[model samples]
Target: MIASDARLAINPNDKVLPSFSHMADAIVRMATKPDRRSGDLLLWSDTFASLRRLFIGVGAGALVGLMVGLNTAIFPGLRAMSRSFLTFLSIIPPLTLLPILFIAFGVGETAKVMLIFIGTVFVISRDLHLYVLQLPKEQITKALTLGASDLAVTYRIVLPQIMPRLIETTRLTLGGAWLFLIAAEMISATEGLGYRIGLVRRYLAMDVIIPYVLWITLLGFLLDWLLRLAVARLYPWYRTGKE
Candidate 1:
């Protein structure tokens, strides 16, 4: 009855866009059915494959970005040396580097992960650098006056304050991360959300395509929610400071 009602809501001649019921049906079919390219089920395998790339790429990038931001903000000389280069990287369209990445790294998982990492790392790093610099110089002076070493001031005084900001930065960059992941997967991956979407596009598989796109969106939302939850739980003080 639900399916029939959904069909009635849409024009019978329309084949380009699937109704919500049709999309739900296609999602189930993809979830249960084995992929033609891979023996594993379509949605399950593709989702995880994309997620693995997302985690590795974003995880590594965030860690490095945090360090870059911290060190650059602490040391003016280092910031001067690399600031322009980092700015250049952040502004260049990461998608434009896809071909070069594929050529340099080949069409493997490495290339896909690198694409996401490169896409996000510079932006996150720069944002955090500016954020850290905004912090009062009095805090650092007090820490040094209290006999804190340079490293001690950085990790002890500054790191805790910035960790929450890192999470927020990661949340903001998640969309770009997905974009790079999808673009890389579409170009060469044998099995991924983007791979499947690109593969089925030739056949005009709106049912599969729509569901997969929605699934990506759902996954992104869940990730963002989780990050927000983590920030709230782990750094209540951060929010209190903001308030």
Candidate 2:
């Protein structure tokens, strides 16, 4: 009776209405079937925990990127110095620095955090410096004429205007940080997805390795999507071309 009613609602005389009703019935039957792995709550819990860690890592990266980017924009000389030093460091693979990091900081959380920070801060700072310098000259002139101090003008006018770009640079840096985490974890991690992957790789467990890679890739995608959503919400003025 419900199927007939739905068909009637769709079209009084359309022959396709019956086909639609059958499709709806099939969907209902599929929905009513019990999930075979209904008892695997532990699996779901572990998955959620892993996801939480990924989110935390991405958030930390974004915060570090934002601070570094802002510092670069405000202090061009510092940006130049950072660029030169970081460029030289980049020539040497981060994995090569692992031994030095371990010797200096030990195989601890500090070394891991520093590795992530080092991989991210330079690129974010450079992008931010370029974006800030590209701001309209007229905007700076107007702010100066209005008796605003250089710092005040930058903080109030310039920073607000370039916030969207800053958010974008942050998103980019967060992606880099994810890559860094894998390398950092490889150094001496006792735990973490990267460590798990390293352990599995020794035994040539392709099954475990594939799932770990997929999990991390999914996490990266989710973090990027969330950041994009945040940018749209916080800076509604930027207008994501979503008409």
Candidate 3:
């Protein structure tokens, strides 16, 4: 009977080990396997696409900066009037112009692009004007002494020296352009990250909304990174501050 009891106890102990082993196996599987759906992957890809758009926005910002920079450098007298007018316009919340833009340019690409352009130009121009005025007179004088024409002096001497500062100014203006785009899209956009966010919000889809916000943030960051890289490449000498 004692031997029978010993065998029965052993049988129960054997079953307990397998049970523990199965539990351990389940825990390991849970730890190693990722719980992601196909939707997650699609979301990631869409985020990347949005990031590309943000980079495009940065390019737009750069163009706007270039135009404003050229205007301020070439025509200092007009700077004040342009600056004041643009400042007034910018202060009027970007969304407020939606109706006007929609009426004039319609709820199309033109209006959206114009909104970004208008939002960025004045501030960038103001920064560029200040930087131009602060440039060393000796550089301008040297260019003139070397038989450089007015246009040549402005392009070769003035522009090259301030190119780094102009890039920095563009970087700053990008934020404003981004803000304007989001507002403009929210006002009247059929497609875009901003539009997607607005749609999700209307439905109270917090999950989708959160991911879209992450997408926008990540895209903005990537654009800023690309701009910095471009600046480093285009103005390598400027990095040392010896230029």
Candidate 4:
């Protein structure tokens, strides 16, 4: 019933654009009101699915990037071997891989998640590798002098020092992650913020599209703010720019 109402609200050949009130009303109805068929209130289920995708992409990408970066920085032999490959992967535009990814992973959740992961990992890894490399050699030397194992020093000494920087990098890459996510969902998805926008676009549902865009922006801002707060609260010793 809600979908039919929405369909009536938008006609494919209709040149009439919806007014701001109409758009706002549509957005409110879709978000707060219920559908006769689904019985589930609002689009919260879709929102949750999108949120899961976002957190998974960011968490996994950050973890892989940090591990690869640390390994590259700490192991000279591994660094020399993997440097060229890293550069190669970094230069290849992630979008160009969409076709290959869809082909390999299918038009499913895995493909979408992989898109976000691949989009972010290289930049994050490179930034972290450079950050680690920039650490003062004296610190490593001091740790060695204390009879600390290289593994112990890298984990206990180096990781803590760079956590703030890693958080900053994660914040920076979020935009690209969103871009990749939206593109993937637009190409192939049943439900996501991007999927909803794409689905509604067929009937020129500017109302839904606009609200979805604002929601995505709001979500990104909140995530970035949370990361900043975590840095301040969890790692009080690391001074951010405002400090």
Candidate 5:
């Protein structure tokens, strides 16, 4: 693959592709450099910062989504209002609202987090509402027959059913969250994996771009794997056990 890329790069009209040797040297140089802008340490720190933004956004969004979803499911009075609002949010392109987020929340971390939040929250909420509605009606009746309150029914019967599903939904939404995060970083972040990649792209730094892209891919894979393991281990009943 590198050889073919080298061949293509050798053509004057084609884009330059750094050889493996150049890439490796770039990695070594980057890893040892003390310059915070492009140093490997800086990259990792920025990556962690971005991860923090992602984690907080997804965590808060999922929790809010679940609460709002369940509330609308249990209380039909609020159903029309909440459902319509969430549906409105779900249909809008999140990227199109970037300027609004920046204007409302500013171009700082708040806007970035809000961007990610909007990207995944409504979708998760809608899916969670569907899952809640699909639950066996008999369970609610059974819990009520035992003298359980509405809140008790939701907590004991519905919440348990959706917890695992929520985790799974979050696993799927991680991709969207990453997209929003990178887009936010590319737009205004001073330090982040996305910012670094966009920065290097201006100079046609293939050696840096390739590794950064691979690193982002690896991080995403690991996050998905961890979520899968959590579902398998913590919610064994939810697992299909297909493997």
Candidate 6:
């Protein structure tokens, strides 16, 4: 017979780390219960606020990046003018600008939104520019041969095709977008997912921290899924071409 192991028979209360069951219970309780300190549900409200900033920041960035990329690809003059500046901007660590942004924007919603925008715009623009350059030159020549004006070629041809690529680029940059959003919120926000996590860190609240982190991950996954579904539904040609 094997010797009985005392260590393996330790009481639950004696354990230093929580069991898997305890963690699961913590997550569930967190979802259902109001915050002890505030007597309010912080999760939903923080999630909404973070999401609002995310949408505004990312939406504006995507639109601007799309325009910059499309024009840079079509016009050599704009490419020459903007390429070096964009490259320089992309290389700068965006987090390093957080203090400046807070100073300039006064720690308001604008600062948080602008952090995400400035972090993501150059990356999306550069990626889209590269994608645009890879598109066959023959398509442009064909349009011109058929007497399509520059505007017609751009809007009627290039824009539609690049829509899928723009969505794809946006999806890819979302991780970084979340990072920037959280960083901004952590630095200067009264209530947000990041702010809550930062607020609870002093107390070593793993229960709240873990759940919030998981919620952020779930939100990111959902956004990526929605973007993918949009590409499939709105631009079937892009998906078929990939396959």
Residue range 128-231, candidate 5, lDDT tens digits: 88788888899888889999998898887899889989999999999999999999999998888888888889988888888778888999999999999999
Ranking by TM-score: 1, 5, 4, 6, 3, 2
Best by lDDT: 1
For model 1, the local distance difference test gives 0.90
Model 6 CA lDDT for position 149: 94
- Would you list the C-alpha lDDT of every candidate in the order shown? 0.90, 0.64, 0.64, 0.83, 0.84, 0.85
- What's the lDDT for residue 96 in model 1? 92
Tens-digit per-residue lDDT, 1-243, candidate 2: 565568667786533324444545433432354436553232244345444444565556556655565656556686776756645554555556667887998987677776665665556556666777777888878889989887887678877877787677767766667676777666577666676667657866444555566667887888779878888899987765754
* Model 3 Cα lDDT, one tens digit per residue, 14-53: 3212333343453343335543643234344444444444
Per-residue lDDT over 67-179 for candidate 6, one digit per residue giving the tens place of the 0 to 100 score: 98898888889888888887888788989999998899898999999989998899889888888889999999999999999889888989888999999999999999999
Better of 4 and 5 by TM-score: 5
Q: In model 3, where do residues sit more than 4 Å from their true spots?
A: 1-61, 74-93, 241-243
For candidate 1, the C-alpha RMSD (Å) to the true structure equals 2.7
lDDT of 4 by residue, 1-243 (tens): 355456557773332355566678877887888868776544575677788887798889899999898889888887898788788888888888999999999998888888888988888888888888999999999999989998998899889888888898999999988898888888898778888888889978777777778888998999999999998899887784566
Residue 140 error, candidate 6, Å: 1.1
Those runs of model 6 whose alpha carbons end farther than 4 Å from true positions after fitting are 1-16, 20-30, 34-39, 241-243
Candidate closer to the true structure by lDDT (higher is better), 5 or 6: 6
Compared with the true structure, model 4 gives a TM-score of: 0.89
Residue pairs whose backbone atoms clash in candidate 6 = none
**Candidate 2 regions with alpha-carbon error over 4 angstroms:** 1-93, 239-243
Off by over 4 Å in 1: 1-14, 241-243
Superposition error at 21 for model 5 (Å): 2.3
Instruction: For residue 33, give model 3's deviation from the true position in Å.
Output: 22
Which of the two, 1 or 2, has more lDDT?
1
| Local distance difference test, candidate 3 | 0.64
